[model samples]
Target: MHVFLPDGKQLDLQQGATALDAARAIGPRLAQDALAATANGDLVDLMTPLPDGARITLITKKNPGEAAAVFRHSLGHVMSQAVGEFYRAKGHPADAVKRGVGPSIENGWYQDFDLPEPLREEDLPEIERIMREILSRNLDFSRREVSKAEALAQFGGDPYKAELIRELPDDEPITFYTQGDYTDLCRGPHFPRTGALPGAFKLMSTSGAYWRGNEKNPILQRIYGVAFATQKELDEYLHRLEEAKKRDHRKLGRELELFVIDPLVGKGLPMWLPNGTILREELTRFLREQQFARGYQGVVTPNIGNLELYKTSGHYQNYSDSNFSPITVDDEQYMLKPMNCPHHVRIYASKPRSYRDLPVRLAEFGTVYRYEQSGELNGLTRVRGFTQDDAHLFCRPDQLKAEFLNVLDLTVLVLRTFGMNDVRFRVGTRDPENTKYVGAEDNWNAAERQIIEAVEEVGLPYSIEPGDAAFYGPKLDFVVRDVLGREWQLGTIQVDYNLPERFDISYVGEDGADHRPIMIHRAPFGSLERFVGILIEHYGGDFPLWLAPRQVAIIPIADRHNEYAYALEAELRAAGLRTEVDDSSNRMNAKVRAAELSKIPVMLIVGDKEQEGRQVSVRERTPEGHKERKGVAFDDLKAELLERYRTRA
Candidate 1:
């Protein structure tokens, strides 16, 4: 048998040789250093038998992407062992702890256990100590394949593991890795030894999760831990998690009075408060103005449509699970609009278009609904009801590139406006093997190629992510790095060839024949709700002057100055600045503190001296701190405020 290396060099070996054997054949040094191997891009343990003619890439600590995953899985095993030890020391039997699945996740790993006693938050530190002790012993991990009957018998007392073994195919080889005093069932790639793992892991927290995430199943205590190749990386990640907590949008949403999710209204349905509403409307107005300037005509669409309408567009078939169940209207089914493209398609087909109207760009702030699981709901980010800054353009093949570029430019502008200027592009192409994706291979290829060409023409960096495409088409996604160094997938522009064809929409070409027009779907904000949620976290609820709901606070120093403050508020309101007059019986300091707490960008203090002089003692919030200008004329202050709002400074 022969296996190929990444450089195309071949190594001849026994037919049943493992990756570790291949590594030894290559060199003793590689065999010693290799933590895991990737057989044709699939990560496998060194002990896993390699198929003849397989292409293998040995992973070491330097290969953080693969190495971290291997060690992370090993860490989960170590943690599981430690949990058993921690329990046994408390007089519980060895098999007292029932196990569930433990898998490596992004930046970490987690294992679920059905414990006789619930694991508390305080138990994490003690578990950490045990985990370190296990790692210190440097236990060698050895794997063995077992027959189905034997595997089932070994885990028969544990229903979770036994059920998993029973579900495996007859031909599937069941394997378990033993390290020190513990063994568990797992599909390989894990570290060769506990010492191979870096001292850069920490047990983060514990939570109750149902076995297999199904509500009807028994609950298990899931412990989450994050691992990295180096201590520095681990430290940095922990710091980011800390910063993330500080910037959590849910916390800020409540503190800033932005939005609320009332149970009576329904889970995942957030009603925007006055301040949140202002923020949303401002964004909508900004995007609308930009779209209008770019020849995009605004249109309104219904919140729900007939089920057949979605069936025609393929959303009903492709995305029915994510979408809400259809509502019955007059004994006919009506679906809450899961997407705005289908409605826009009908609008395009309503009018017979010619080559002269080659590019028909229709824009909408259309509200759409999805059936999000209750547990998956997170503030405004994951919601059942949200409005998308959605638009669809139907254009002739010749104009497709220009139209796509125009939408891309608009998306970039939106990102830039929000200080998410550190942008990266991801081109999501269809996965050929995925039956869920709809459309011809040729159309998918063409759509993908056009998006790639446009991104290249703009001279930006991008990556091609397979299986990230919309079911109907390939898409260009914008991943923006916010102020905290966390990346969010924000805006998207998809070039769709399937939907137009499915809808049978056509335009008269110059040759006097009808031709199917290419369709482009774009949403710079993605959704107003989610974008604002990110914005709330990105800005830490201190929005820019233009976007701030309460741009100015007018605080009268004393009761006698209330008239002046009210007049100033009216003036600022008339000038398009959002202002609130702090006219309560509270003292001037209390009023100022209240204004600051509300995150108003500006505070105007009026008193006898200012009222008599027709001026304001301005206190403006800046990154540097509160800046004060005494007795600035009302005209000058108004001009400065207006300029900042105009320029979005």
Candidate 2:
């Protein structure tokens, strides 16, 4: 048999030869390091024999990042073995511990377990010791495919494993992995041996996780561990986690008085504080100005609509659970809008005609509500009620490409205005099996093709992701990474054909006939509330001069200088900067420290010398050592700040 490798070379092999065998045949050294193989572009255990004439690529330790998830998955089993051993050493029977499914997640792995006694964070060290011992033993991992009944018999007394087996599709084969005396149910592509756990693995923490991620299921203790092929990589990842923790939006939002999530107000409902409101209003103002400049017509729509409105848009069937329960007002059942599109569609349907009106762009800072689970809520990023800076463009089929290109230009401009340069875009397409999509195959293909061309024309790097599409459409999601390298999904441009077809929306064409319009739904700033929260952390609350909630704070060295501070504040405010006078009795050091802590972008000092000299000392919120003590002409500073604001920086 011959299989073409990812590099396009064909390799001749014996019948049923696996990728592992192919690697070994290629070179002796390659055989020694081969961790697993991607057979036909699917990651599979080395032990699994390949189908005849399959594409093969052996993943190894050197480029282990691709196989990291698989590696962490195997390490999970290694941890389970160590935990069982630890339990035995204490004279407790291993059977008392029950295991749940453990899967690999980004940067780490976690496994749930029902233990006789709850594990403590302090107990992790001893568990680590046993894990190290098993790693040093260097046991070879062995795998077996068993019959469904045989698999059930193997885990007969283990309900978690048995339930897992019972839940799998009847046609799916059951497989088990064994290393030393420990056996686990898994479909694995392990490190080939236990020694892969060498120095780079550690049990980080434990949390309560429900079985299969459902709150109604039994709660099990989930122990999380991060693994890498080398210690340096592990250290770097750990350090990054620490930095992310400090800048986590949930933590920073509270400390900065940006937003509040009150349990009494219901989960995922965030009330913007005064400062947070200021941020939201500024972002809205910026987006409205930018949208108007880009030829978008601002549209106003109610927050609730007749239930049939969503049914026509295909969201009721797909997203009804996420939307708030419908409100019954007399004879009509209205739903709190879960999306802005349904309303925009109604607007487009109100009255429309002609190819000249083809690319009508409607923009709005529309507030929508969704019932996100409490556990899933995280600050402003994931929330129940939020506003989307949304717009929908209705265009002719032939104009799709140009409309997409214009949107790309607008998206990049918006991102640059916010200083978000590390952007990643993923083009999301359909899941054919689901059968919920309303468009024809050709229309979906055309939308995807137009987006691909526009994305390419912009010369931006992107990836295509399947199964992430809207049921009515395909979309391009723009994600931005913050200072700590944590990526946040911020903007989106969706090509929707299903909605227009379902709504029977059409406009007059050049041929004097009605033609269906292709809808392009977009929001460069996905949500003003969420974007501001991310921006706070991305800029570490030290917003660029124009966007800062309080752009400049006036500081007085002593009580005698208070008058000048007030004068400076009034002058800056009148000149169009958000300015404040700090007339507190605290000393200069305390005042300056407070301003710095609050992340005020600029501080204007009005001491007796500066006041009498008719000048103000300016201190930027950059590092202290980078300070410049010179005063700018009052009018000059104001003009510069206004320019920055006008630019939406």
Candidate 3:
């Protein structure tokens, strides 16, 4: 057999050789350090036999993508074994603890367990100690294949493992990994030895989860742990976790009076408070102005539509799981619109168009509904109903590229305005083998090619992601990283030819013949609710002057200064500023503290000197040092505030 390296070097090996054998043949030092191997871009265990002519990239600890997952998954297995040992030391049977599925997640790993006795938070430290003791032994991980009946006989008393084996197909290989008398059924790509795992790992927390995420199944205790290649990396990650806790949107939302999700109303349904509504309205106005300047016309659509409309759009067949159930009234079925494109399609078809009317851009801040599961609901980020800054462009084939570039320009501008300038693009295309998509092969290829060309022309950084496209078309998703190094998919622009064809929408061409138009669907701010949630966390509740709900707060030193403060507020409001006066009986310093806690961008203090000079003391909130400008003219202050709002500073 022959194997190829990443650099195109080939090696001849024995017929039954594995990645470990190849690594040893390359060099002793390489074999000692190698954690796993990627055969033809697929990560595999070192012990797994390699096929002829396979391209192999030996993964080390420096390779975080595959190596980190392998290390973390091995850590999970070690933790589970430690749990069993701890139970046996306490005079319980070794088999007293039953294990469920355990897998490596983004930065850590977790395992589910059905214990004979309840586990508490204090038990974590003991489990860690046992894991370290086991690591000191430096045990080797050995893999073996067995028949389904033999595997069932070994774990038959443990219902969870037995049930899993029973569900596997007869032809599929049944594999198990064993290390120092502890074994588990897994499809593993793990480190060669237990000592290969680093000591920079810790148990985070525990939570209750149903078996396989089904509500009717028994609840199991899930333990989570995070690991890294070095102690420095672990410390840095822990610091970031602390920062994230302080900036949690749900906590800040309540403290800032932004929005509320009440179970009394319904789960996953959020209603914006007055302060949050101001944020929503300001964002809408900003985008609306930009769209208007870009030749997009505003259009309105109903919240519900006939079921037949979605059937024509192919959304009913692909997205019915996420959509709310249909409503039947007098033998006519209607659905709460899950998306705006289908409704917009009907609008384009309502009247006759021509090449002169080609590239008709229709825009709306449309609200949509989806029946998200109860467990998946979070703060505003995941909701049952939300509004999208949606638009659709109907254009000729020749105009498709220009229209796409225009939308891309608008999306970048919107993101930069919100201080989310660190952006990347992903061109999501259809999976070649998936039958779930509804479109011709040529149409999919054309749409995907156009998206790639647009991104390339703009010279933006992007990657191609297969199986991430919508059923009808290919899309370019804008992923932005925030202040805390967290990524959010905030905007999207999709190209479609299937919807127009399904609805048979066409326009008259210059030759007086009907021609099908291509549709470009876009939402610069993917959803108002989710965008606001990200913004809240990104800014840490301290919004910029232009987007702040309350632009100015006026505090009176005493009752005597109330009149002047109210007069100042009136003048500021007249100058197109959002202003508020603190008329409560609290002291001057207390009012200042309250305004600071609320994250008001500007604070004005009124007193005797200000009354005599007809001026106010202004203090601006900034991330850096704070300074006060004493005795500034009220007119100048109003002008400055208005200018900032106008320029979106």
Candidate 4:
């Protein structure tokens, strides 16, 4: 047999040679460091046999990004072994602890266990100690293929493991890895030995998770641990975690009184308070102005639509999972609108159009509903009911690229305005093997090509992602990294020929014959709720002058200054600033403290001297510290603030 390396060099080997054998044949250093290997892009353990003519790439510690999964899986097994050992030292039976499953996740790994006693947080340190001891032993890992019957017999005392083995597909391989006296049922691509695992790992936390995420199944204690190739990386990740804790939107949402997800209102439905509503309105107003300038007409749609409408758009057939169950009224099934495009499509079809009105751009701040599982719901980021800054453009084939570029421009402007400048693009195309996608093969290809060409024309960098497309057509998704270096999928622009065809929508061509129009669906602010949540964390609640919920807070030092403070508030409000007067009976210092805590952009202090001087004491918040200017003329203050608001500084 001959196997190829990444560089296309071939090496003759004996039949059924494993990756470890190939590595040894290539070089001794590679063989010694080979943690795992990928045969034709599939990661596999060293013991797995390499197929003839397969392309093999051995992974080592130097390739941390790719090798993290291998070592992380080994860590999970080690953690589970340590747990069993810890319990055994306490004189429990060897089979007293039952393991469910442990898998490598992004940045870490987690293991679920059915323990003899509830594992407490305090026990983590001891578990870590045992894990270190085990790692010190340099136990070599060995894997073996087993029959379903043999696997079940080995784990018979552990019902979780037994249940898992029974559920395995007949064609799927049943394999187990053993290190020292501990063996686990897992199909693994793990580090070669315990000593090969990275020392930069920590047990972060634990929680109760229902077995396999099913509430009806028995609950298991889940322990989470994060690992890195080096201690520096681990330290950096830990720092980011701390920073993320401080920027948690849920906590700030409560303290800032921005939005509320009340239990009485049901889960995943967040009600925007006055402050949060202001944020939404300002964002909507900004986007609307941009759209208007670009010839987009605002349109309104209903919250619920006839099921037949979605059925016509292929959403009912292909995207029914996220959709709420239909409501039956008078023998007609109506669904909470899962998408705004279907309604917008009807609007375009309601009346005749021509090449003269080729690009009919319709925009809406449409509220949509999805039946997200309760456990999947988070604050505003993952909500059932949310508003999309959605729009659809129906244009001729020639105008498709131009219109897409226009949308791309708007999305970039919106993101940059919010200080999310670290942006990347992903062109999501259909997965050939996925049957869930609905559309003619030619239509999907055309739509995907149009998006790619438009993105290329703009000279923006992007990557192609398969299986990330919408059911109806291909899309371009924007991923932006926030201040904390966390990435979010924000804006999206999708090109679709399928929906227009499904809806039977067309426009008169230059020759006066009916021709199908291409649809460009875009939502720059994916959703108001999710965008606002990210914005909160990005800015740490210190919004800019234009977007701040309360831009100016006027503090009156004495009772006599109340009138002056009210007058200042009036003038600020008249100048299009969000202003408030703090005349509540609190002390002047307390008022200043309150303003600072609220993250207000500016605080104006008024007193007898300021009133007599026809000026105000200005204190403005900045990244460095508060900048204070005493006795600034009212006109000067107003002019300076208005300029900032106008530029959205």
Give me the candidate number with maximum TM-score.
3
Total clashing residue pairs per candidate?
Answer: 0, 1, 0, 0
lDDT tens digits, residue span 300-390, model 2: 8998999998887778888877978888999899998899998888888998678887788999888899888777787888888899989
Model 1 score (lDDT): 0.91
lDDT of each: 0.91, 0.83, 0.92, 0.92
List runs of model 3 lying over 4 Å from the truth: 60-66, 625-627
Off by over 4 Å in 1: 1-66, 328-332, 606-615, 628-631
Give a tens-digit lDDT track for model 3, residues 243-356.
Answer: 889889999999999999999999988999999999999999999999999999999999999999988898888998998999997899999999999999889999999999
Q: For model 1, what is the error of residue 304's alpha carbon versus the real structure, in angstroms, after optimal superposition?
A: 2.4
Off by over 4 Å in 4: 5-9, 12-16, 26-34, 61-65, 167-173, 607-612
Candidate 2, run of 10 with poorest lDDT:
623-632
Question: How does candidate 4 fare on TM-score?
Answer: 0.94
Give the Cα-based TM-score of candidate 1 against the true structure: 0.91
> What RMSD does each model have against the real structure?
2.9, 2.5, 2.1, 2.4
Candidate 4 per-residue lDDT over residues 425-506, each given as its tens digit: 9999999999988879998988888888888988999999999999888999999999988999999999988889888899
